[model samples]
Target: MKIIAGVIIVISCSAMLKKDDVVRQAFDHAAKQTLVMLKEVAIKLQAAKAESKNPMPVAPRTLKDGDLVVVPSRDWTSGFFSGVLWYLYEYTGKKEWLDEAKKFTAAMEQEKWNGKTHDMGFKMYCSYGNGYRLTKDATYNDVLVQSAKTLSTRFRPITGVLRSWDHSRDKWSYPVIIDNMMNLELLFFATRSTGDSSFYKIAVSHAKTTMKNHYRADNSSYHVIEYDTLTGKVLKKNTHQGYAHESAWSRGQAWGLYGFTMCYRETKDKAFLEQAEKIAKYIFSHPHMPADLIPYWDYDAPGIPNEPRDVSAAAVIASGLYELSLYSPNAKDYRAKANTIVQNLSKNYASPVGGSKGFILLHSTGSKPANSEVDVPLSYADYYFLEALLRKDKLEKTSYKSIQ
Candidate 1:
């Protein structure tokens, strides 16, 4: 009885910290974890180089078969590890993190000209975009602009969408996954960089088209939209990575929410803001949302407690909500929701010190429907989780000043 009372008191005290204090502690924990990750990755890179015949550099993706998995430049997730490093540099102002980030980012330079994939924004922009934003580096700006041009090539004027994949034509003639919404950030930056609105125009067109066709009545987005390339008609709405044809894939919703919120930020378009809010309402009001605010791999996934939780989705949504709160009239509610997500993730999903194979968060399901990356620590999860921490810190500072 005495021990139980002691535990209850500890829990009560932990729950009583101010939101800013919780965020500060989360950031400190994340900083230490990032340093450990950097060191582990460095060791893994050295081992991979020693074993590779070509000695090409690689970025860590996740743990596979009990070893750190490193992906080459062409992999879709290749840039996220570097992006995480950049955030760590921003958060900690540590020269070592910046130097390591530069090295990993430079390795992706050649991908700026690779137009075969729709992931140029993920491969180039996430690394160089953050790099340029943080350091004002002209070289990083050039890479980002070129990547935007390369990504633009994938956009079909007739379809009004960027082609997400080429080989799945039997599934879609010109496939445009909801995830492509994320790539618009590169194009928006290009317009600001080059004084050419072509990139901006394409970004807006894609967003408008996606807004028209991708969402269900509940505002939950489908995972993939197949278009007739010649006629600007949607061939099908499919859930390639979701549990069912009509199910809401958790990460897809996160991408849509983040992307539209970003669109509003770049253009200040009221329509985009409304769309973001609608999506947020759908997600937050959904019955499947766990009491902890973490969601299953799919909101409609058949299993509940037995199903994998998507920490990546939670991270992305938390980051998006923090940004959305700054712009929305319902700022307090959005910030409070975001605060809850960040606090829950920091306490529950975050890997213990020296655990998770040097990754930060765990239990992210990449594509459970496809039977890939189930219950693992993903690089993008860490990237967005760090982003949420930084945004929360920024919001706290802003609120403190307003109070003063």
Candidate 2:
């Protein structure tokens, strides 16, 4: 009897160890592939810089048809590669990654004064913001404050929201997209850096207005909300990238989830926390969410298993849920969901050693409506995936309260 009991105990112990070993292997695979992708991009960036006296500063954007898609520094996604480099440095404590990160970040310095669009946060904060956070560079702080000022120029106090674009006037007057929620972090950071309350006020007002108008009854958000600039009335609710005018885009949902989770972190606002929980419920309860936890481009898109999955959306959701899990009442559930997403992405969506043309996550649909960038690997997807892993690693090494 004693011998039989010992055998059973050993079997159970071995099974647990095997499960832990697989998890560790998945994380190490993700990190090593990311390093390869960064080295591949650095070579291209150096070549692009050598070709012209005043280069546009090309960097990786996505992989389409097994080829790399590089974009100019002014592109909205340009900051993400730099951000990913910084995260790599943070993870490996490697000086080479830090050197490359500074080079990419310096190439994007001109975006601090770019006021033509609402993506300044995506343009500056992700790169310079992370740079500043990690290094405490005074120069990066100056650029971030100026970037916040430029981003503020688009704020329409009458509408209590930041105008997203000036060119889409033919369709709407003053448009505010749900993705703008992600940019508020730049504003909040600026206030803290400069001791200016105006930036904080604008950010809070934008969050409140978005909460009031952007969300539908089901807590899923519309892609775009047009408002009367003069009268502050909602002009229209439309979908620019989703399957239909009323469908919920997968990335849009992830943006809302990440934005409010971040908002609660910055302000300790219970309302924002509750909103994030509701969004999580909507996503988890939706039938369209795949069994593996990756979602299609749009939840309401016609094809079920036939639809292309958006790994970028999954990456963003997992990153946000990791932070959200630290503060929510459903902490364990949120953490488990985030782990499932990370596991699925690492196992299925991740590119093998030399498969992704130096990009990481696969099958990220950019805009199905516009017939653009479908089933590709995006740079931002790689950024958020690394971020989720780093966050999880930090949580494991130290308690959540000791993170800061």
Candidate 3:
């Protein structure tokens, strides 16, 4: 009996080692493929920049009718490509990636003062924020602080939330989309870097206000919530990119999940942590969630199985879950779900190596209702996918408690 027990233990250890190797191989393959694809993207972006009259190309957003759609630094998604480059630099420690990241990140520095839109965080933080985190460049520090100031300008003390859009005034007086939750990270970073409690206060206020108003009874988030700035009351709950006002927009839900998890990390507030867990429960327990964990563009979209899978949403959820697992009591379940998401994204959603015009993953829906960027590879999808992979690798190799 003793001999048999010893053999069982040995076999179990061997299987564990084999599983680790397989996970490592998956990460390695993803890294290699990403490097190859982004090189081609860099070459194409150069040509586009040379030909275009607009600002220099910051990143590739997606394919439009099989053509690469590169956008300028002003675009909200401009920072994601730079973030991806930074992630590659983090993973491989390659000088080439470092140089590329700096170049693209520099393009976004001027946006620190562009207060026309509320995407200052998406534009500056994802670029300069990552750059600063990696290299601690003093120049990036000023850029981030200025960016946070610009973002703060959108915040209304009455509303207790930052305004999301300046356009569509007739439709919404003070629109606060669920996506705005993501920009709070810039505020939190600013406070930490400068010891300015105002930035922290604003972030906390926004998170608290959003937590109070953005979620349904089931914890699913609305895509847009318009506020009466005068009274600080929610005027309407609407949907610009979702299927309906009442439907669960997959990407919106993902943004909330990631945003709250990050808020908890920065604030150590149990409310934010609990909100993150609730959002996670809503996402994973949805009856419509695909078996592989990728979700359709919207949970209540007319078509179910036939709807386009939003790989971007899956990437964001996976990344968020990895972080949430570190703080939640259900750490094991969260980690397992995150692992499954990464595995499925790597195995099923990844673009063919050397294909898809250098984008990493395919079949992302940016805004299906608007007939824009449907069933295509988005830059943000690739960024979050790389982030999730890195988080997984870090968690696996180090003790989670030590990381905290």
Task: Give the best candidate by TM-score.
Answer: 3
Residue 71's C-alpha lDDT in candidate 2? 78
Model 1 weakest 10-residue run by lDDT: 395-404
lDDT of every model, 2 decimals: 0.88, 0.86, 0.88
Global lDDT of model 1: 0.88
lDDT by residue for model 2 (48-94), tens: 77886354655789876666777787788989988988887787678
lDDT of 3 at 215: 94
Candidate 1 per-residue lDDT over residues 232-336, each given as its tens digit: 898899988799989999999999999999999999999999999999999999999999999999999888778999999999999999899878888889888
Instruction: List the lowest-lDDT window of 10 residues for candidate 3.
Output: 395-404
How close to the true structure is residue 84 of candidate 3, measured as C-alpha lDDT?
Answer: 87
Error of 1 at 81 (Å): 1.3
| Residue 358 miss distance in model 1 (angstroms) | 0.9
Candidate 1, pairs of clashing residues: none
Candidate 3 TM-score over all chains jointly: 0.94
| Per-prediction TM-score | 0.92, 0.92, 0.94
Q: Which whole-number lDDT from 0 to 100 does residue 333 have in model 1? A: 90
